[model samples]
Target chain A: GAGVSQSPRYKVAKRGQDVALRCDPISGHVSLFWYQQALGQGPEFLTYFQNEAQLDKSGLPSDRFFAERPEGSVSTLKIQRTQQEDSAVYLCASSPRTRTDTQYFGPGTRLTVL
Target chain B: QQQVKQSPQSLIVQKGGISIINCAYENTAFDYFPWYQQFPGKGPALLIAIRPDVSEKKEGRFTISFNKSAKQFSLHIMDSQPGDSATYFCAASENIRGYGQNFVFGPGTRLSVLP
Candidate 1:
């Protein structure tokens, strides 16, 4: 409510297992984004949605990485067939407008692939 | 390819000193630049931002300097405090003739402020 929120702050999955992370954006936000951050590195863009429309997904590492904002208020990022390299912090951010604006980020989900 | 480049992988500064972090980008189309600050186990927060139209912008103790010709920008924290110790990232984005814009972030700079 106050800001962006993410569920399952931490996740541990075995190789080949599938996992889904959820994000709840600020109320009435029009833009949502997902990013992956590896150890000691900055966040890399994964996908972006504008009011339930998947405008861009070119940054997703692989086809296994899929994201959806069906209702536009909430979003989910599902990773299928996880690999060791998939272990990283997944971040969700929301902006008030569809155009460039200040984004509020959630705590992020730390996915550890064993 | 890395669209954004940052210098000084890590920095240590004393309290009350000026802390500076630099970043460069190759894409001239990037018109918006923002700097984010992050703490351990937390998400990044928007510290300050600047547009290409202005050469510099200041808010409180933070300042963003932009060099349009060189496609470079930097963040300056005045009177650094120990509480300011964190990782800083510089990001750039262009208006993609679409509904939303994508961001390109640079390798972060870890700053430690000594009290």
Candidate 2:
């Protein structure tokens, strides 16, 4: 309740199956971001949302990757037709307001595509 | 695409010793540099940060040294402790176009502090 929270800390999905991850940002936070981190690597930005508007989805790897923040508080990342290479940790972060604001991060959801 | 490169993919340091991690960026537009500490099963958290305007920033046991001309920066952990062992990541971003929310993080350095 005090920090960002994510659902289904671990997910095991078969290849070609679809999966969705959820993120609940800090209350009153106006910025949210999603990132994908592969093994032994840092987080790579996947998308960004400013309030309820999806400002950027340039980082999404493919059309199968979709994200939406309808209310500006909770967000979801959906991956369709998942592949083995899609296995990675999905992270969610929220900022208070401005660009310079400190970002609070969630524990992240580890997606395993088998 | 902006890239942040971090070195010493893995490190082992003794307790009370100083641990240093280095990072370099290719983008000149990046004005915000931040170091994040992440433990297993947890997301990375902001450890310390330094802007290009300043050459150095110190907070308690952590220090960030920035070199504008070389586009390099480093994180120094003074008196490293076992509890400090974790993965450290360096990230860069620009405030332009509200893109600050999208940070380009380095490959990360896994630090192991031995007691």
Candidate 3:
């Protein structure tokens, strides 16, 4: 079975620019989550989706962050007006169903804002 | 605020020795506890998990000891090997609406096993 995967393994953007990171969850996965991991820190939850419905967005750091999962299998995390503080690895994970606690994670997209 | 706190930011152990990492949580509502292992340039993978119902669970050489009354849990690696070196994260979540909600992660512990 294919594992969850993220695109643009690495990205560099200038401050004030916009960036979008993509995630492809395992086929048929019903739960998708986004997390941010800073250097030497554990991953922090940013948002969560159950199928196509965005269930939780409380973990999003600020209004500049947005996420969507229109089709339920793929998701995108968009950061507007990127800042140097946003430089970190963006990780995506998925689970079988809403209640499943075991999450399978993607390799993650490392974003650097200059 | 960070709900979970992990101790020993880093650890080094020799092969065949025992390795232990500890974590504490403040929320009593957290019912599901899971540990994740991550290597450089890779995403975290589920190492092992335990619920509040169990005091301890062992899988192969990895063991999780949970102390419900103290709101603490720990991971013990027996006969540590070089390949076991990586970063370990402890996380907790409350079962809400049939889903594990609002996971709180610890700071993480970097473990290095020397042969």
| RMSD (Å) of each candidate, 1 decimal | 1.0, 1.0, 1.1
Candidate 3 per-residue lDDT over residues B1-115, each given as its tens digit: 4489998899999999999999999889898999999999999999999999999999999999999999999999999999999999999988778445667789899999999
Off by over 4 Å in 3: none
Instruction: Judge candidate 2 at residue B87 and give its lDDT.
Output: 99
Error of 1 at B30 (Å): 0.2
Steric clash pairs (candidate 1): none
CA lDDT, candidate 1, residue A42: 92
| Most accurate candidate by DockQ | 1
lDDT of 1 at B39: 98
Q: Write the per-residue lDDT of candidate 2 for residues B19-99, one digit (tens) a residue.
A: 999999988988889999999999999999888999999999999999999999999999999999999999998886655
Ranking by DockQ: 1, 3, 2
C-alpha lDDT of residue B9 in model 3:
98
* Root mean square deviation (Cα) for candidate 2: 1.0
Give per-residue CA lDDT, model 1, range A1-114, as digits (tens).
799999999999999999999999999999999999999999999999999999988889999999999988899999999999999999999999988668899999999999
Q: How far is B65's C-alpha from truth in model 1 (Å)?
A: 1.2
**Candidate 3 residue pairs that clash:** none
Q: Report the lDDT of model 3 for residue A92.
A: 96
Which should have the higher DockQ, number 1 or number 3? 1
Can you tell me which runs of candidate 1 are displaced by over 4 Å?
none
Model 2 TM: 0.97
